[model samples]
Target: MVKRTALYVTLVAGAFVSVFPYLLVALTALKTPRQLSGTEPWEPGLPPTFANLDRVMHSGFAGYLGNTLLMTAALTAGQLVFTTFAAYAFARLRFRGRDVLFWLYVATMMVPSAVTMIPLFLIMRELHLVNTWWGLLAPYLLGTPYGIFLMRQFFRALPAGLEDAARIDGAGPLTILLRIVLPLSRPALGTLAIITVISSWNNFMWPLIITSGDDTRVVTVGIAGLKGSIGVDPNQMTAAALIALVPMVAVFVAFQRYIVRSVVLTGLK
Candidate 1:
């Protein structure tokens, strides 16, 4: 009883800690410019208003949001399709030097993104891909090592009996993968999709560098522009930040079950 009570207390405390900053941001977004600029940053001074949201939306935020959504959706889909196939091949198929190839792919993950930034930029420039959505998504759409690794782990956990049974029934490799493995691996796939969307949506550095104009600007870079334009308008910035967070929060809520299942499965093996 004591242990259970202590565990509950810890969980509640952790939840509070996680939620407090968002609460502060919510309160600040509701404040007037004057209230936000005043000395007490924590104190709620007025009733919530939608003025800040209105201001942000009017300031080209709609375009940015659209661009972000498109980029995230495309990147997530591309990552899942490519990574799933690659992971399935690595996990199930026998090939020449397969282990060596997979290890080499995993080794690439050890190299930090910063190390490859200049080379990637040069390649993009050469291909005239800079300042385009293609440029922004090029690196991610190629299938991330981490995504491949995670999918491979999940696929490895699956029973080979299903694949064997499908083969005995004259199902081809692609048929088995599509009808059997993918259907059973929905939880892992959902988790990957969520992670990919979140990462691509919130991507800042690469997009900031690659996309030079309004035609390709994503939300994170657009938010930075908003910060620069508004300068000291904390209310506006807070509202914009909240707007940026909504989609990801909605996604998490929608896929909460799959996300939990994925984590539990991953932990088990």
Candidate 2:
């Protein structure tokens, strides 16, 4: 009983640590600027107001939200399609130097984006993709090395009997991949999709470098601008931040079961 009590206490403490920041941010969003800037950070008194949220929305938050959603959805879909195909080939298909090529791909992950930022920017400039949504979406769509690696690991863990049986029944590689492997790999793919969406939605550095105008500015970058323009308006900033978190939170909550299972499988493998 003591051990169980200790374990429960630890778990509850951990949960509180994870959730407390979000709770603070949520409540701050409801506060007025005066309350937020005052000495006491935790005191509660007045009724919550939506004026901050209203101000954020009127200040082009809607446009930023739309741009972020579009980019995130596009990047996630592209990663899912491209990573799954590449992972399947690496896992099931025999080819010359496949392991070498896969290792090289993984090696790129070790190379920080900062190292290649200049080159990537110059390439985008040459391609006339800078300051556009295509600029934001292009790098991610080509199949991220990490996404490929994760999918490959998941694919490798799948039973080979399914593929062999499909091949004996006159199924081509493409047919088998589509009809067999993909359906069984939904959990991993869903997890990857969720991860991809969140990463793309929250990406700041690349978007800041590539985009400038209102036409392509995403939520994170937009929030930075909001900060500069609002200048210490904590309530407004908090409201915008809270709003920015909504889509990713909704996606995670909706697919949480699959995400948990995928994480467990990935770790076990």
Candidate 3:
């Protein structure tokens, strides 16, 4: 009984440590500037107001939101398409030096993005894509070695009998993959899509360094600007930060079951 009580206590403590900061931010959004400055950072404001949220709504928040959504959706879709095709070929197709090429590609994951950021920036500049949405999306548009490796692991885990049975029924490789392999892989796909969305949505450095104007400014960068030209309004910044979290939170909540399921299945595989 004592051990069980201690375990529950530990879990509750851990949960509070993880979530309390966001709760503080959410409370700050409800406060007025005076209340935000006067009260403790995490204290819930009495008689909360929506003025900060209203102010943020009117201050180009919609534009930033739209830009973020577009970039995230485009990057995630492109990555999934390219990653899926490449992973399938790696897992199933026979070709010369296939293993060598795949391992070489996977090796790129070890190279830090910071190391390559400058060169990527120079390449974007050479192509005249700087200050453009395309530039913001360019660095990571085609997925990563990590993503390919993840999908490849999932693909390789599938039974060969499935493919062989389809082949016996006159199904081409493409048809077999599309009909059989993909349907069974929904959990992995959902998990990958969720991961891609979160990564793209939260990405800051490349977007910050590449795009300079409001035209291509993503929500992550746009919210940072709120700390400066918006008169450093803590209430507005808090509100914008809360607004920024909604989509990713919604996505994780919606797909959390699939994520857990995928994790378990992948472990078993």
Candidate 4:
């Protein structure tokens, strides 16, 4: 009984430690300037203020949020299409040099994106895609090495009897994939969607380097600009950051079970 109590205490303590910073930020974002300057760091304002949220919403943060949403959706759709097809082929289709090709493709995952960033930029510049939406999306839209590897593993682990039965029913490869494989792989797909959304939404460096115009600027870079630009207050900055964090939090809340289930099914630590 004592050990169980201690374990619950530890878990509660750890959760509080993890959540305390965000709680502070929320408090700060809602406090009036006078209250914020005068009060203890952890103290809540006598009454909360919405002026920070109003200011941030008016400062073109909405545009950045829209851009991020569009980019995330496009990247997620493209990733699902390419990753699903490629993973299915690698797992099910018998082709010459298949193993060799898959391993060679997987080897690219070891090569850090920073190493290739400059070369990729130069190619984009040569093609006159710099400062364009296409430039931002083109590099990642095809799918990622990690995404391919994850889906491929899940596909390979599926029951072969299902595929064999489908084949006997005159189902072509596409039919089998669409009707049997994909429907059964919903958990893995949901996991990939969450991963793609989080990565694309949080990506800052690549978007900052690739595009300079506000027209294509993402929320991550926009949040950084809130910090550096003249006359932007800390409360507003915190508010903008909190706004950006809400969607991701919502996504995880909705699909968290899929992520846990996929991890268990894929045997990933």
Model 1 weakest lDDT span, ten residues long: 225-234
132-251 in candidate 2: lDDT tens per residue? 878878888979888888888888998999888988999999999999989998888888887887789889999999999998999999888865643666777788999998777898
How far in Å is the alpha carbon of 145 misplaced in model 4?
A: 1.4
> Which model, 1 or 2, shows the larger lDDT?
1
Q: Where in model 4 is the C-alpha error above 4 Å?
A: 229-232
Deviation in Å, model 2, residue 243 alpha carbon: 0.7
1 against 3, candidate with superior TM-score: 3
Which lDDT values do the candidates have, in the order given? Answer: 0.87, 0.86, 0.87, 0.90
Clashing pairs in 3: none
By TM-score, how accurate is candidate 4? 0.93
Give one digit per residue, the lDDT tens place, for model 3 in 1-269: 99999999999999999999889879999998788888998788888999988899899988999989999999999888888889899999999999999999999988988998899899999999999978888777777887788788899989999999999999998998899999988878877888788889999989999999878888999888887753687788889999999888898888888667656644665
Predict model 4's lDDT versus the native.
Answer: 0.90
lDDT of 1 by residue, 1-269 (tens): 99999999999999999988888888888888777777376788577678989898999988999999899889999998999999999999999999999989989999988898889999999999999878888999979988898899999999999999999999998999999999998878988988888788888989988888998988888877765643656787788889998888898889778767757755775
Write down the TM-score of every candidate: 0.91, 0.92, 0.94, 0.93
Against the true structure, candidate 3 reaches a TM-score of 0.94
RMSD of 2: 1.9
RMSD of each: 2.0, 1.9, 1.8, 1.8
Kindly list the per-residue Cα lDDT of model 4 for residues 39-118, writing each as its tens digit: 98799887998888889889999999999999999999999999999999998999999999999999998998899899
